[model samples]
Target: MVLSAKTKQSGVTSTTNMDKPNNSKRPLSHATDSTRTSESCDVLVLSNKMMTNLTSEFLTEQTTQPDVISKVLLERNKLKDLPFELVDFINLEVINLSYNCFHQFPSVICEMLSLREIIMVGCEIEALPSNFDQLSGLETIILDLNHLRKIGDTLCTLNKLTTLSLGMNYFSVFYSTLPDQITKLNLDNNHLAVFPDCILALANLRQLNLSFNRIKELPVEIDGLTELEELLIVKNRLHALPSTICNLV
Candidate 1:
């Protein structure tokens, strides 16, 4: 697989080329786009060696317009200008913009129609779009080490989400509802004291970590999670874990 960047006056567009493996002549179906009229490459796949050298060069040349690319991994880049306008391209499935300097909420992110996993950890984001719940297809959201104060009510609409991490954030608000689809949860090193009983609604959760928080007691209904496999509350101010917790394991 080879990465090629095409630059226009607006920015850069990337194309991934695959050298034919001698044995297999089958065509690879990168994502399809209905509105794209001209010849275009919608997906790019690169090996570890190619990704290490060209990821930054590919992104730096982007044209600041809607991209046809479906998946972008730009972690640990010195990225300052996150093209919010590019979010209108709903074809993106996975984006890794971690370790950048993005501040405040990025509203355009909510418009990505196919985005499934977003890893924007340590971006310094303080809030999210108000209609953030509209991202119905999102499955994994990693916002660890940001400056978020509260999770918007729209969070309950991400029914496909399986893993969530808000560790090291400044979450001051209380959560009254959590999506039932969540299977892995991490709230380590936050400022939460207690959450509403509605937390027990996640009956399918398998791993839950609330270590390093200021929580004092467990909500009695928490034992209702019969599928829970690991529950870690190592550094919280718990007097005693509910006997129900022992029953789950």
Candidate 2:
């Protein structure tokens, strides 16, 4: 559901299995481009496109229906930055910017207040933008395979965040910044060498993954996750399981 504009430089269309974005030059409802105006787009798949950026020509028309787009998928591109013009999509909720070479978190996303999910896997982002927690509607964030080592207290402020994935990063020590609101967490393939004591405080965490790390033991305090339905700790250096492991049902 992205603009099927001829990229001024690459001559690419930047879309996968959806309708072309509406513009003054195109019909309101083409046979394929059915998402227009009141028929808000639910998903926009722009993955695997070689696009480096979304230019003004592609963004010039989204303002005509600021509430039309709900999701934008921009994975597997060579993008390093995003156009600020994206702020016009007032109703946008989900965004996937995976497999790009982004060195920094795109700050423009912090302004999209309606966002509920953000997926930015395999990027180079080492830090989140300031005031990131202000997007109070966010529920899920996947930042796997990035350069992140620490995220401040910003994440815990989003009360709606329930799912968090932070695998394959540069983390050596776990950060206690995790919120109790999280029900699912993934920290596989990092450099962690200890069972992070902070996780024992998450009374609401239902599933935890700590596979492929250097951890040598699980603590008896892990029974604090009384609600845990699934726990994975394969491929670690543990000599034995904690005695309280049987407490989790």
Candidate 3:
């Protein structure tokens, strides 16, 4: 599945129809009262009888033809663990589990081989699974507003990854090395104190965001990012920009 637009940071709306699921009866889950105020809940209220029938049909179809079930949106469900039945969707390519109460990255997602994009914003995720590299087809990952302190080295093994967003986290250092295929990277609103030299290795990087951090200075080696087009360094502690930045002109 081709993603036509980037995931927005404000709300759970998408610009493309691909983000919408095929079944109209299945609505996106909402935040539970324990996770959010009742006034904030946007759950679709269905009669108990209707819900039971829908659930029965869903299980039957999923059990018989799991490959037909692709694209899942469980946003704002306050879920700590995915339902075991979700594993039946073997052909899933896109999944959005954003705005939940997860304390760790759900291991069930790691088992999906066809996943191309995953959005898990505003959660308590601390770390990715060690075997996250198993998702070779993954291209975009948005983990903004989580509790991640550092990423595993397995992330760099996703050679097809092009867009990665890790903003609004608690990272104090850039520990994980990025893949050279990355085109857009967002590290804004973190606790980084140093410019990671590993970023210079992304020869295909076109957009980079380092805003709202504690970085003191950038290295002259940044000039090596010849493909960079838009660089955002706002709200940082940088004293001066390197003269080599003018080379981009």
Candidate 4:
């Protein structure tokens, strides 16, 4: 990997060179900034053909745009209307497809057993597939800024999910089933007025973002999120948080 550095008052600003090779059959890798800077920042160029040759490839914790990548970003790229047959060729372990314009998630994704994480933020998706529970190895699923109103029980079956993002959606239905393995959850920008008790089941949860919602009060049992580390409740209608949260932050 080649490193490019620039002068900054704080220190050296470095960007990794991840340009994709010019190959039509290659799986391009797109790069996303953890800081959420610009839309045209960088792409994590990859060789789709080369990656297909490998048995196991892990690409955890990477962000992507909507149009180019299938796993990350807002608008589906019109140029990448791959056939459903290509689903079997995918071997990605982590996929961050947040902030996109997909109306619905492809049903073929259920066949991808190798996918460990799926991040589809700001998409127009409404509901997850019924077979989503088949993803036994899935550990993280971030689906923010969507038009979804309810989560399927199939999703709650992902017992290995550690992080979940359901922010900016239409949660009209009451959540009764929550994954037990979630450690970080983002429920900001929703239509919630009260903190649901169902979330307390996540014994390992460390961070909870509930900002920009219609919540007016919190549950007293919120301290049940024992492993809580950071709780972001900004821009909400909440009058106060439980005193127990003070020690977690």
Q: Which candidate should be chosen as best, given TM-score against the real structure?
A: 2
TM-scores of all candidate predictions against the true structure: 0.71, 0.81, 0.75, 0.66
Instruction: Find the 10 residues in a row with the least total lDDT in model 3.
Output: 23-32
lDDT of 1 by residue, 1-249 (tens): 221222222243322344422312111111123212333465432212223233334544653433567766555655545555455555788766666666865566777778887777787988877788888898888888899887757688788998887778897545646789898787767887885455588889876766567777787777688877556555556665556544554
In the order shown, what is each candidate's alpha-carbon RMSD? 16.1, 14.7, 11.1, 13.7
lDDT by residue for model 3 (64-176), tens: 66566556655655566665565667777767777666788878788888898888888789888898999999988888889988885878889999988888889999877
- Computed on alpha carbons, the lDDT of every model, listed in order, comes to 0.63, 0.72, 0.68, 0.56
Query: Backbone collision count in every prediction?
Result: 4, 0, 0, 27
lDDT of candidate 2?
0.72
Give the clashing pairs for model 1. 11-63, 12-61, 12-62, 12-63
Question: What is the per-residue lDDT of model 2 for residues 1-249, given as tens digits with 9 covering 90 to 100?
Answer: 121222223434343234432431212111122112233355556678898887766765433555677878778899898888778778998888888878999888999999988888888889887689889998888888899887767787788988888888888888657678888788877889998877888889876777677887788887788887666665667666666766664
Query: What lDDT would candidate 4 get against the real structure?
Result: 0.56
Select the stronger candidate by lDDT from 2 and 3.
Answer: 2
User: Runs in model 2 with CA error above 4 Å?
Assistant: 1-40, 61-64
Measured by lDDT, the strongest candidate is 2
What TM-score should be assigned to candidate 2? 0.81
> After superposing candidate 1, which stretches have Cα over 4 Å from the reference?
1-68
